[model samples]
Target: MTIQTVTTTPYNDQKPGTSGLRKSVKHFKKPDYLQTFVQAIFNTVQGIEGSTLILGGDGRYFNREAIQIILRMAAAAGFGRVILGQSGILSTPAASHLIRQYQAIGGIILSASHNAGGPEGDFGIKFNISNGGPAPEQLTEAIYEASKGIHSYQIAPIQPIPLDKLGTYELHGMPIEIIDSVTDYMALMESLFDFDKIAALLQADHFKMRFDAMHAVTGPYAHRILEERLGAPKGTVMHGQPLANFGGGHPDPNQAHAKELMALLFARKSEFDFGAASDGDGDRNMILGKQFFVTPSDSLAVLAANATLIPGYRNGIAGIARSMPTSQAPDRVAIKLGLPYFETPTGWKFFGNLLDAGRITLCGEESFGTSSSHVREKDGLWAVLFWLNLLAEKQDSVENIVRKHWAEYGRNYYSRHDYEEIDLKAANELIAALLDKLPSLTGQTFGALTVGSADNFAYTDPVDGSVSQNQGIRILFTDGSRIIFRLSGTGTQGATLRVYLEKYEADTNKHDQDVQEALADLLTIAEQVAQIQAFTGREAADVIT
Candidate 1:
């Protein structure tokens, strides 16, 4: 294979966010903007002159066009082969699965995960490492440096390779393999879960359920699993289509964006016993009951407690982890099991090193992501299936099971309120101000609240001893109540400030109340401590998860 190079100038917005380089479509459409970054990825990585590359995207706006450009560029960059999904549509987890299954060098995932998509919306390109995890910090930094002074991007003058057929073809004498998008992924899921039991549970009508795909990438996977594979009726899956615009929906599976489905469950209250949804690229997830919401913290705890019920996890869990901002529910479980409990930085990438080194088996974040050793990246549909399998084994309703778990282990009341798209500079100022006051806040008493400690979080990766500073600011109270504040890294526009409140009550009498109402007093203290209202100029949060 012969390689070619084309000279070009650097584009300014190549800095990757928490996930990857995400920005408005217009930002990516600049002359040589996408090409410059893609070339930087190839040049910075090793052994790509004649190696296999996997390519696909979330089927968002500009996805197909970007795939075409990338294909030509991959050929020109001297890749020996490219494994692409049909129509270049692969959910994030599926792409990760493909890379691991085929042992490809790495893959380019075209997605601005959970961000809106359309001609006028957003687009993103992320490179997954050979292990199917997001590129580690070093690689991302190298790519960023390369983007700063990129002088050339290589692409061959060739017709667009057809992606609809599942067969092998040759481009510039390089092999290109188009694989069935669902086959390998489905097989993997079947191996990990008990499909027979899940099907039996569906047939028994043990519990009515609804899955909303949010008009994004998970629509097909949801439909195939719930309707075709598990024998759910066709309409049980909602918004089952892949639209560039996400059918005018936000495509985020949080309470704010999925209010419609939430309202339906609350109103009917009879047809649905379980409710779940997946985000745009199929990584984030939200799970609920008819009138009961499963806080992400509680969900992770329950999954960790019952992980042995699943076929793949029947040997007992290896370890558990949660992002620093997430509540300490899993910590309680970890203590019980004598397992290693880890607290990492917010992004899912942090868990990859742990999983790769066998230091942990399961990890989750407050951002509605959960996964295990099954895959490096968070798996949304996988979480749903896990809950389903648990339901089958327990033969109990969602609320009942959660209530029982709380009764046994006590409750960790938790809530996260998000102030979206605030001025970035002002938000940073607010955080800095809070960090400066940490010393004053520590060991102080105000009313019934006595501050136990306060500090800015710094993480030292146990395996490598690498340090990550400024992960977030945290305040702990003598009463076991805590609050954390940070700027969200996944937002596409202005900064998003997230405040997480947590309190543990060992008393069963007060366990069943609503989370926000339970944490009302702590919320007041949090606002006062951080001066959140004055800083953001908003009295209330945009969304609470």
Candidate 2:
């Protein structure tokens, strides 16, 4: 088994974002594109030689090809073993779990994560460290720097091994194990949640829930957990099959992308009692009740408030954490529970240190991400099951649970407006102008709302003491209303500007109003603060969630 070193030129644009290196499939198809990045990751990671690496993907287009190439590279790079998922399928959260469960040195995941798939769509590669979390900023920066200067990559001269097999084999002196992707993940979920209790809830004749996989990676996960194990009806999991192109639909689980589920759940009278959807890699979730949409911010608060009801968190949570852009609803819950809470930047990697240090047990983001200390990455199905566990234990409707929460701690009328595919420089200029005026605009007024404070968000890691500045620009009103603006780091095209609007309403009666109507004043104020329309040339937000 001879190793071959193929000389190649470097690509300057292989820098990683909040998660990993993402680009269009065509861009990745360029000569030595994926190879160069893989080599860079191999060269940058600390003490990878003779280590085990778990490898898989989200079942997107070119996933199998990429898996084969990575296996060959791992063999030549002197890895002791490579654990590949059957059919090259492993959702993001599952990969994290496997990396921890097997005690592997690290892992590689191929996914674009809620982006479209296929030849024309997006593809991504994320590297996780020994702790089973996304690589930290310093490590990602090292990978990017190595990518810029890489000249060659090594690969074993061997034919592709069959990924469908279920046993271990030897390839180029490296042990390759292909295992069922769903089995271990299902087992992990069963341990964290009350399987017997959830089964009883699903068996109830009046209880009905819809789990929409969006034809992405969560399809098999949902089918196994919700239908087979829980004894729900066979048809409970909709779109419950992984497709390379995600059935030509965007895999994001939002009102805009998951129109069918949202429409059914938002109807005047929905047949189902609960509905849920997950993103492409199964890390992000959208939860809905009949005629109700629970904002992700509110969902985190509800989970924190009811943590003691579930088996896994019965003893109570240590603390909580949320991204800066996420609403302050969780803060209220944390205050009531007398638990410490930390606000980090927009990336999940920021929560790794907190979780590992045992400073926090639950962490989430406004981008439909929620998870506990179960694994480093967010788990979509886990959130859904947690919601189900709460619903069953209380014997209450989702709407009533949310209303009760609001009655206790007040409601946060929250919405995120996304401006997609706009000019990058124009968006930056808008931000630059905001930064220039942030200090002077504190006392100014936007309509009846008086600005109390404003600043660019920053964070000092409590565990490591590292500081991250310029996270986002946020303006707070006197009455606890907020408007936040930030450019997205995950898009494949032009800049994507996300405007987050939030208004705290203490009156429970006011919670029944439409979302846009509830935040109308903040919406207008956000545009006025950022000059969104004038700079981006767009009238309405592409997606509001």
Candidate 3:
């Protein structure tokens, strides 16, 4: 094989957002676009030679093509070994586990993470460090700086390597080990969960579960673990096949995107005991029971409350952490357990340092991200199994479990309203006006609530002592209500303004009210405070979750 450096110019828009460098597939298809970003990653790491590089993706449209390019580049970059996933399929969580399990120097995960996918849809790539977590803000900034001044990229002149075969293959003298995508991840789950108890529950005649993989990367994982190993009846897992286009639908597991499984669970007198769905990369999960939709915040609370009942958590957890915008339910649980609780800024990357230092055993976010110390990235299937393990041990209905939790810990009525595709200038202006007023609003009143504290969010990493400022703007009311405002960092088009609303209710009877109605007061105050409709010229939020 001959190594060659190809000349290319830098693209100013290659900077990564909340997750990674995501753009329209057409944008990535521009001359040397993907190569440019990959080369930037190479330059930032600066130690690719003699290091093991793991590569895989969510089996999206450009997955295999990207893998081939990266493989040739890795060879030319002088990596000693490259671990490949069979058929170029590996969920985000699986890739994280592989990075740590194999002690690979780092990894390249090709995923847009819940974004729509196709030739006309979104595409993305993020590099994770050896700790099996997304690159921290420092590294991400370094990559962005590198992407700006790149002049050339290196690659080996070599033939294409077969991606579907499971064996060792040589490409440009670099050994590529193509392995099963599900086995190692499943092994990690087996160690943490009581498989025998879950198997017995699934074997019961009356217990029924519907797992929607959404035609993405979790198909094989859910099928093998839920059906083959746990004795679930055939066809319990829906969309159990990985499709490049995700079967022509956006593979997000939200109610609007994953309507098939949601319909079955919402149907009158639905017989299914539980229903769960995972996003394109299999890291975000939405869980439902009968007609009940469990919000991500409540789901984390229930899991923490019932930790000891699940075999994996039999030994108990140390502490808990959650994104600042997340509900205060976990704090209630942590308080009950007398464990330390932390609230950090948005993004799963913030939880990695805490999880590693053993300061927190479980961490979650309002964006349907939940996981423990078992893996750096959130695991959708892992959360599902943890719920199942609790259910199997408790022998209670999902409704009962949630009602019981609220009865003990009170309920946090939480909702996030997102204004999508707003003009970038207008959105930034809205936030700027709010930031300017944050200091004066300390004692101001909105509707009958007095402001206790109002400021933009910031955090200092406890383990690494790194600081991140200006994360989001938040207002706390004297009545224990909260309203948060921030622009989302995960979209490709115009800005997405997210307004999070929450109010705590300790009365059990109050928990029965509609979530929107229960939060109506806070919602109104938030709009009044931000003049949302006035600034964005929108009557209502684009999406409420």
Candidate 4:
């Protein structure tokens, strides 16, 4: 192995956002922009002159181009080997699994998650640590600092490796192995789920299910798992293609983006018993029942309550966790199980330490992300498989099972309304104005609604004890209801204001109301509590999730 350095000018906007360095393709095409960031990643990590690294992407636009650049840089940086997925396309969860399977030093994933993709749209490059999770804060900070003052980046003028072939090649004396993209991942799913049982359920016509892939990375995975493995009809999976532009759709599995699936569910009504979809990169999931939408909050609780039915969770759940802005349903389950319950700041990395420390077996976010000890990251396909296995074991309809759960333990009604792509300045003004009035809002009383408490949420990691300030703001009512406001960290441009509403109702009579109707009053209060109109200068939200 040889070490070298080459001088280059630094580019602005190299700072990574919530996940990674995201920008338009033109931005990444600037002089030495990608090289500088790649070099900074290499420079930040130590003892990687000849270590194995993993490389792959979500097959978005610029994926192949970025892979070539990264290959050249990795060879120049003296990496021993690179394990890449065939066709240079690996869903986010697949890449995480490959990183852990190969025991690579780290992995580079090219994706902007559910964001739009094209030459003119968003592009991203995220680094996952050796533990198969997103790079920790310390490592990300180091990479950012290196990017700031970078004067040069190293690269070899070598021929680009052919990523489409499933074979081994040599690039500057470094081994590049392209493996079957879905084989190992499918095998892992098999180990975690009982395919034979699910097959029996499908063959017996116990339930009718529909799975939408949204034309993103999970298309193949869904086809294999739902159709081939589970013995469902080939047409059971919809939108089964890996389109760079995600078929001109948002590729998010939520109700707003997956309206087609939602309509199909409602049109057929009782025909389909279960419906589910995964977002781009396959890290987020939305689970729906026939004519019933299971909020992410309720989804996590249901999964936790029935975890033992799945072989992977048979040892009993180690613990449970949820993002701070998510409803507190899992906390109640954790209490019942006598296990730890963690409330961490948003982002999947916050749960990494707890997962590594064995403090939690299951964790989820309100943004339709759910996972357990099966993997470090939230896996959309995995969550769907969990629901399938649960359904197979219980032999009941999704709605009936959920209704029974509510009957036994009560119901926690929750909803998150997202105002997407608003002006940054306006969003910040709204948050600032709300913070200024927090003191006054703490003790005020309005009709039947009385403020019980209020404050900005600040988190201190239990395992590492790292503190994250100004996460979000919350206002609790005296009647066991609350409203939370925060700007979404995953958006590509403009701010996304997320307003979460939670109210606990132990009465079964009122549990059957529509969610939007149930939260109608709180939605109004949330708009007023945050002064959304006065701050953002917009009367209506762009989207509600």
Which is the leading candidate under lDDT? Answer: 2
Which ranges of candidate 3 are over 4 A from the true structure? none
Please provide, for model 2 over 240-287, each residue's C-alpha lDDT reduced to its tens digit, 9 standing for 90 to 100.
899999999999998899999988787777788999999999999999
Model 3 residue 220 distance off true place after TM-score fit, in angstroms:
0.9
Better TM-score candidate (3, 4): 3
In model 4, the clashing pairs are 8-152
- State in Å the error of residue 415, model 2: 0.3
How close to the true structure is residue 110 of candidate 3, measured as C-alpha lDDT? 94
- For residue 351, model 2's alpha carbon misses the true position, in angstroms, by 0.6
The CA-based lDDT of model 4 is what?
A: 0.85
The per-model lDDT (C-alpha) reads: 0.87, 0.93, 0.90, 0.85
lDDT ranking, best first: 2, 3, 1, 4
Candidate 1 local lDDT, 1-89, one digit each (tens): 44567788897668787789988898888888899999889889999988889899888999988998898898888898999988888
Estimate, for each residue in 143-205, the C-alpha lDDT of model 4 and write its tens digit: 988988899888777587878788999888889999988888899989988788888877675
Worst 10 residues of 3 by lDDT: 249-258
Candidate with better TM-score, 2 vs 4: 2
Q: Model 2 segments beyond 4 Å from truth?
A: none
True-vs-predicted CA distance for residue 43, candidate 3, Å: 1.0
| CA lDDT, candidate 4, residue 151 | 95
Q: Candidate 3 on 1-545: residue-level lDDT in tens?
A: 57989999999998888788888888889999999999889888967788998889998888888899999888888899999888998899999999999999889999988888889888889998988998889999999999999999999986789999999999888999999999999999999989999999999988999999989999999999999998899999999898888999888887778898988999998889999999899999998998998989999999988888877789999899999999999999999999889999888889999988999899899988899988888889899999999889989888899999999999999998989999999999999999998999899876778999999999999999999999999999888889999999888889999999999999987889999998998888888888889889998987888
TM-score of 1: 0.97
Cα-based lDDT at residue 460, candidate 4: 88
